[model samples]
Target: MTRHPTEHPQFYLTAPAACPYLEGKQERKVFTHLIGKHAPTLNDVLTHGGFRRSQNIAYRPACEDCRACVSVRVCVAEFKWTKSLKRQWKLGQDILGARLPTSPSSEQYDLFKSYLATRHENGGMTDMSVLDYAMMIEDTHVDTMVLEYRSKGPDSFITGIGQGPLLGVALTDQLCDGLSMVYSFYDPDFDGIGLGTYMILDHIVRAQKLGLPYVYLGYWVDGSPKMTYKVRFKPQEHLGPDGWAKVD
Candidate 1:
């Protein structure tokens, strides 16, 4: 049976740009648009092949003379919480992630802006306006969700919603095999809770509850300090020339 044109994604290479993860290095990417009824299927396949989703686009590094970007996914069923991980988890026990729609809001944008200002002032996303942030959350064709992390309220047990100021946000994608953490941000002032690491632990538990075996954590650049946290989620698999293989 011949596949439809949309099912056979056409990829395009990006123009070289300064690498975000490495100094004095350039980066290029090969990307394909995800659309139509087959978008979810294409997302799953491309993700397993080391591609990452950004809106309707699925892309992977196509840089010349570079192989630092490695796709990582936590093995949900095999994950064992470390003492530090457990401490991080307990720190956020008063909060929970509430699944919301793809719609963006002023509150969420406020938190996003603050996070960018504090944690990534000199980074690429620092100039994103509120509209740009909205597009990032709303411009999607595949399965996606906005997980709002907030303080648990009195009626949380019944309504399953949280109250108080938003502490963090996770833009996640539910794929055929697992939840892909497309993006996440938190209030930098609210330190000591380890919100970033706590969010990943939540995703791992969520994946297990849903019977998903993996939690895609996107690319883990070998030498990038920003990516070092990814490897701590042990019992993970890294995509390679051969295929997915366990990496410690």
Candidate 2:
């Protein structure tokens, strides 16, 4: 279907692919290009409707039998940290995180390579090169940002870029309603730091400060240990066939 320039973004279906979260299921996506003059506005609407952005593509699960992929957003206003989350913050207390424009850097690529090698060696994105990484961060047509986490320097204002190695990174999209976590990675060497959990905590705070009510945590697939972490943030909402419903 041809969509007018003034119309909302139009979507298309993807061919079946192996489900990344589930063991023996196939997955498909309903996607659209979020570009042109209406990208920012289109992005907001799509996100509210449970779509996720990767570069300029906005997609959501379109599986035939499984509805396991649930879009979740933390209600920043009502989010209360668990004792462990507080301790996770303390564990990563020394790491300084700064949000900057979505521009790619070699340091990011290096760390990304290391992370993929160690954690996702057999994953689909394992072979992505620096140019691919660059595109992932910089090719966006809508509002996006990169949050870099590292060890802080002595000078606050003139602090040097985090040196030695990259600790963590968050690829986030700034929507009209909230911050969508497009992707994130951390130095696997710092496994004990719980940087993944800490980053989510930080984003919740950031969302509240921005006066945004939600922080999109992407999909939470039931029975997937990798996705179970997303449910820890309380007072979150999940998108269902009926609509966004409050989850425990």
Candidate 3:
């Protein structure tokens, strides 16, 4: 009997639900638990093929007859920083970011709770408890890391301890080709300084320094104003039926 390589993935499809990005639409997802020894390698391959990791489950939109959501990745080597992007870079200069292993902490959770309460109060994760938050950070089965953003300090050791209040957090996955930004949140009070954009910009620079090719930015829905910002990162490639196509 012939066996498929993915036979061991234990895939499942989510029940149809109302689409958050598009009006009068429904959405479904094909997902699987990314655990066990092969999880890291499988996740890398899966993400390159358009899957996104959320905690331990890797999922992709599987809504019938709908193709509005497209996966995006920035070509770090080819990216050109716009004038506005440069300004954002300077704005975030006072911020120090530390990439650490996938572990949970009350300090991080406090910032996460505040961010959700302020920005995603009506979203699915709004009701998540501290336990839920811990699981979200520590349940990963792949090569994932959490980047903690804080105010820069006078010394590296002080920076490692991260002085001042937590400013932002990014859950990221390192793949063979690039880094996939699983999720990110920040202090809404810092919104005016463009922390969100600056995070992505920093990821691009991080990717370049890591000798990686791309920085996967998850999905981009064409008409969704909420997701429009993902498109502003120029020289990005959108995954389509024909394969990865560059969007100028």
Candidates in descending TM-score order: 1, 2, 3
The global C-alpha lDDT for each of the candidates, from Candidate 1 onward, is 0.93, 0.88, 0.88
Clashes of each: 0, 0, 0
lDDT of 2 by residue, 1-248 (tens): 87666366567999999998788999999999988878888889889999999888989999999999999999999998889888998887677778888889998998998888987887889989888999999988888889999876666347635544579899999888889999999988886678889999989888999999999999999988879889899999999889999987
68-151: candidate 1 lDDT, tens digit per residue: 999999999999889999999998898989999999999999999999999888999998998999999999889999999988
For candidate 3, the clash count comes to 0
CA deviation > 4 Å runs, candidate 1 = 1-4
Q: Candidate 3 local accuracy as lDDT?
A: 0.88
- Give every collision pair in model 3: none
Candidate 1 lDDT: 0.93
Which candidate tops TM-score? 1
Error of 3 at 41 (Å): 0.9
- The order of the candidates by lDDT, greatest first, is 1, 3, 2
TM per candidate comes to 0.97, 0.94, 0.94
CA deviation > 4 Å runs, candidate 2: 1-8, 157-164
